[model samples]
Target: MVGDALASSPGGYLLVLAVLVPVIGMLAMPVMGLLRVRHAASLAFATIAVGVAVVGAVGWRVVGSGEALVYGIGGWSPPLGLALRADGLSAVMMAMAALVIALVALYARPQFAAAETAPGGRRAFGFWALLMGLWSALNLAFVGEDLFNLFVALELLTFAAVPLVCLDGTAATLEAALRYLVFALVGSVLYLLGVAVLYARYGTLDIGLLHELAYPDFATHAAIALMIGGLMAKAALFPLHLWLPPAHAGAPAPASAVLSALVVKAPFFIIVRLWFDVLPGASHEAAARALAMLGAAAILVCSVVALRQARLKLMIAYSTVAQVGYLFLMFQLTIEPGVPAWATIGWTGGMLQLVSHALAKAAMFLAAGLIAEALGHDRIDELAGAGRAVPVSLFAFGLAGLSLMGLPPSGGFIAKLLLLSAATLSGAWWIAVVISVGGLLAAAYVTRVLKRAMAPPPEGIVTSPVARSRELAALALALCAVALGLVPLQPFDLLAIGRAGVALP
Candidate 1:
């Protein structure tokens, strides 16, 4: 079954390139910087262009062919060798990572641009290199077929992301970085423990083999529980989310954008893989409800926290936690038996929420950065001059806010609507109520910032002008979030590709 499902397709080699391109660029960055610091940024951007194109090609092939693109290393099949595979979900995630990373590179270019003889080129060069490394890890996480291979991807992701938080070298940022590292390391340990248990039980670490061989035994149950608990911490779900706000708020804007938009999603994606692919039959309705309960708590608790934040970036960071809650809700809503989970409205809604939030949150972080630049501060109270100084950014932030608020003609609205429908059909009244309440809370927090920004500037406060190019980059991302609303209000066929007969894992 695993072999039949994973046979290499026509464009399978693209998956190998998808992982390799950014890695090659990451290795080349330091060499370029050593020769000429300005050349490093150029190399990173060149890599971004090619990487985005490669990911795009993969997505196109997946959608056009409606098959999983698979490439086994050294022409050896799984369980004995490695493989990279891109199904619909993998393609979409890779595309999302590529798009967000590229836009972030654009936004960071002006700020990090160094002269041929600039003294502090290390910071600039580090940003480009780390960004490449992050991109590489993300692609690997999305495509890797072996469990231990995914573990390596997760480790690379953590190391690449930790340094991004403290790029400025401030005491506070360094502390935040260290805190993030500790939490991520704990997650890695639990995840590895689970993988070890699975390997000992089944003697192979390939996902497809595990899917075929796994049974609802004590070891399997315990291993999955440990792995899920660890992933929840990495994904910043509810009670374990303490490290997220500080790290995201402390990082530079471009770094903040990718961290919030793409980095955290990687773990959540793995959680999905574990639940649906690795142990589908072992999943219980009670356990599913428990996960949704935690998600509800996150939505309620984090939304209130966001509303209370005084700093713009901190508020956005808290909002990320709340938005992530929506993804967890999908676990329960997608429990319809005899139907593939990917074919359900809940799955579509959850995926839409992920994509929309990624675009919107990236835009909001970039906009907040520009707003901070214009006023030399991010205090929500002092944002009165932002509308006058950087109206484009303010507008971009508001547009992105529309998605969070679940307003009409935006992706968030469609996503929540679908979730609400699934809850209604399944008689999950509590989930339905939480979805609605989450929207209201989102609106309250968004309006709190917008109202402040629209007010007149305080007496004698002058604002600096931001570059239009940077402002437009943010606006473009926000627009993409809005454009997702055009997708039909149903389970997407694109997402269903490569998921036939497979229950949601």
Candidate 2:
């Protein structure tokens, strides 16, 4: 079923269109120079909405027909041509990206409006172009079956995202963008080196082929190590997270949403593919534990740092680093020797972590953005009357924080619960302890922000009112994160639909 789910199909033309539509819009912006930002944005939104529907249709077919949708470019199979494939995980990720990007587009309508004095303004046009490019790259990353294809997707994603980081063109933002570029370039080099190593040894870069060819050899291990290390840096998985807070906090709100919610997850998804799908046996228990240890450190350290943050946006950014750490624990917990990878609770938990975090973090960032707009700042300590001023935004923030804190009826709670169960069952007591401690630390930071936000303010606090529709947009995204907790606690068969014949040990 793993191969079948990813097998090429005529219906897979939808995936091609899904990725290409956004790229087409981005390229056509210059031609549409006469179109105002609003008109151009409308066209981009309409086109991308259709692209999203195509992706949804593919996912619907994948789920209903119990097979992944695949398109081999030019009707040629691997070893001769490239391919796009969507399994359970890929479908879920693409769908998530589409939904988040759409809602954010709605939220950004007012934020990116060009001043009439500057027709075809740089900031507005650049933001939309970068957004479309980012969306295209992400869709390709999810569906790309070849390692080289994924590499290109990652590069496109980086190029699109790096500019958004420095959109303001301030000296500080420029430095952040340059730093992000340097780290990302280093990661790209390491990842490319691994791809080269694999191609030299096996003569093909297709993940499905690599699954059959990879072995417990020194070169194979070396390649995976390099690739995973590179992905960790890109994922901002602690220690290498120096560039994350500044870049994420500095970018405009919409950019921050996509960067924090979607951009980083692309590399982490590749890491998952490399470990479980491509080189399962090559990744041993000891190596998994090493990654999990680093994750634990991130959860411990970053959560505390978030708690100490003075600015609301900086706190949220640091929280993202800590949230990323939890996903790595799936590496440790999914090591049951006799069980298939997708059948495990840890596997489901990890994927849940990915989807829920995307929704919740996007909501959190947007809420912070609204707060900053209203108050002209996001100082956490001065947020005494901000909540009363913008109740809806604060409410959205609290809901998103529930997921981050792993509170009841939130997706983060469900994900962490499943992971905790898996750790206890596996007798990984240390991991269980780490999960509990991480949750507490998460709670501390969230409560810290809420405590200040809810406090009574001194006299003479100016409160600017935010648009109700924008508030609804943020709230809706937060509700999606919370809604994921309603699903039953069991192995998600949807995620397992593609792994039936994989050579898991």
Candidate 3:
């Protein structure tokens, strides 16, 4: 009985802390800054440490007990009251968020440190506060068991993220931030309309209740379609990804890392919930294939576009869109009507791609920031002296690129391999072909940057030295991405821990 699995297990209070600590840290930032600006940074770091530990503890409990951890809020259970739950998938996401945010903080510390009452201190404090808010929203999205609550998290996420894009206050970045805001608000409206439709029909917004109550009807199908469509816009999947490149490329590197690696994933996570958890009986193979086709387009088209980008950050931004395409492929690969999707190799591959991409992309962006810092600009053709100026950053970029290219002993390799195996097993040969072509395209673009970066400097070029600690921070993330490839090439049992007997939609 999965019901027993949601009975407010021991150590469930950790979920409350996971969400609360970040909110508290965010609220406290300004107050601490009144006395000393640097205090805000100290508090933010402390919050990160505590949040990471809380997530680690929750993950430990879920894995050790081999069960989902659930906490009914205010002593009330579902359909009437809210609940927070951490299944293995949720645990993995929370852990990934914690790790990425922590490492990003490490990389951002020197730039965003409010050590003195300089003009930059205010922006620094704002960055830390917004980051905490974003972390809180991400945690809530992962743990919340109600549809409306997840929407609230999404709203918080959008609000926190929009300001980050224009933090530099440049005219172009401001325009980009405005564009991102418009798209995000549109997605929110669509998602909210779906939620309203669901609540009107089902009389509840709780996901578990909807799982049992929802049937394949006009209302159900309409709501699910609306919700998924909105999420696709937010996730920056192809055709809807217009705002992503400019916004991500314009933002500060740490903010860029967060937006690419985590912010987009939140909405996609909700899409997963809507598809598999709330609408388990609503599986439509045609719809699944359609989503996969979009993914294939994203992979092929974006990779080609990325290859032509002149700016390092823009190329990485486009690569993010392409990598996201891999996630949607899981729908077609794992959509067995009666089988739990998480038990499949396709599902595991999709998730591994998410984690590895988060790590790799974060590393890539941070390294790009260092390269720009040392070389004074991010122009690809002008990057001749970058290797000599920021060798660690260049090496980190190459290491992260290895994963993106699906090279051996890297997470992306294992993930794509699993996806290919699933496609072949299911006789979805077209998907297998797309996967291969995507890898080759990714390789071409990644090597394009590496080849330019490793070349000798042109005459009269100047460079500055970047902090070794910052370069090491980026390297750490890249190493983690590669480390994921060490896991055995098979469906992960851990991902299936709470999904046993759960039907796929």
* Model 3: per-residue Cα lDDT at residue 496: 70
Number of residue pairs clashing in candidate 1, backbone atoms closer than 3 angstroms, sequence gap of 3 or more or interchain? 2
What's each prediction's TM-score?
A: 0.97, 0.96, 0.97
Global lDDT of each model? 0.91, 0.88, 0.90
Q: Give the distance in Å from residue 69's predicted Cα in candidate 3 to where it truly belongs.
A: 0.6
Clashing pairs in 1: 276-505, 277-505
Off-target runs (Cα >4 Å) in candidate 2 are: 1-7, 34-38, 115-120, 280-283, 501-505
Error of 3 at 296 (Å): 0.6
For residues 458-483, could you state the per-residue lDDT of candidate 1 as single tens digits? 89987888889999999999999999
What lDDT score is found at residue 45 in candidate 3? 94
**What is the C-alpha RMSD, rounded to one decimal, of candidate 1?**
2.5
Question: Model 3 misses residue 169 by how many Å?
Answer: 0.4
Provide the RMSD of all predictions against the true structure, rounded to 1 decimal: 2.5, 2.9, 2.6
